[model samples]
Target: MSHAIAADQREHRRLQLAPTIIRADIEQDGKSREGYLINVSLGGAFLSIADPPAKDTTTTDLHMLLPWGIGECHVQARTVWEQTDDQERAIGAGISFIDLSEDASNQLQSYLDRFKELSIEITS
Candidate 1:
């Protein structure tokens, strides 16, 4: 599906997030899972990861290293949706931000703006 349509469906702003994959350790179970993030809005983020919190687990906490070398941001997120393959392996997940720092939010917005500019350049 096109990014725009997917974003629209999810009620998220469509932006080309230059994702940086990272290993995430959740506070709940102390389980280490790979998480993908680039630009995240208040609504949700499109994450490409191998393992994710199950549908039963509604909430998670993460220490994410965002762009701008601003250090890790302690983030609280809620799992909105998750999709897996027949192998029962997670392929992607959508997480809604429950809480975020002001600096982190600003950095995310900047990343989104840059992604938009890059997309426009490519399409035009």
Candidate 2:
């Protein structure tokens, strides 16, 4: 298979998460905004907030709360894109993880794995 096809299939294989309330603290340029996580995959996550940073805003410090009694995880990410509503209000932004500590990566992978397992069980 071609590389493009494989990449597309990998994107499609990401688990679709429900609207779980995961807290997120995003910091950029010495400013911080608290928000809720919308969805997540191993590559990236969508964060819902009242005021997203500028489109070109790249690096950010992200602190996220894990579900199922798991503790928090901190990682650095780059903002890939931003979204807004019809009213021009800031809705959310998509961020790709760029820097993750070994522990944080393991924690996030564990959480994602559990979520995937639960999802499969529900569908089955």
The RMSD of every model to the true structure, in order and in angstroms, is 5.7, 3.9
Q: Spell out the clash pairs found in candidate 1.
A: none
Where is model 1 more than 4 Å wrong at Cα?
A: 1-27, 38-40, 67-73, 87-90
lDDT of 1 by residue, 1-124 (tens): 8987676666664444554454444555665565775336545565556676666365677666655554566667777677777476447667777666787677666655665676789889
Model 2 misses residue 8 by how many Å?
Answer: 8.6
Q: TM-score each candidate.
A: 0.61, 0.76
TM-score of the candidate numbered 1? 0.61
Tell how far residue 116 is off in model 2, in angstroms: 1.5
Candidate 1 weakest ten by summed lDDT:
14-23
Q: Against the hidden true structure, what lDDT does model 1 obtain? A: 0.62
Best by lDDT: 2
lDDT for 22 in candidate 1 is: 48
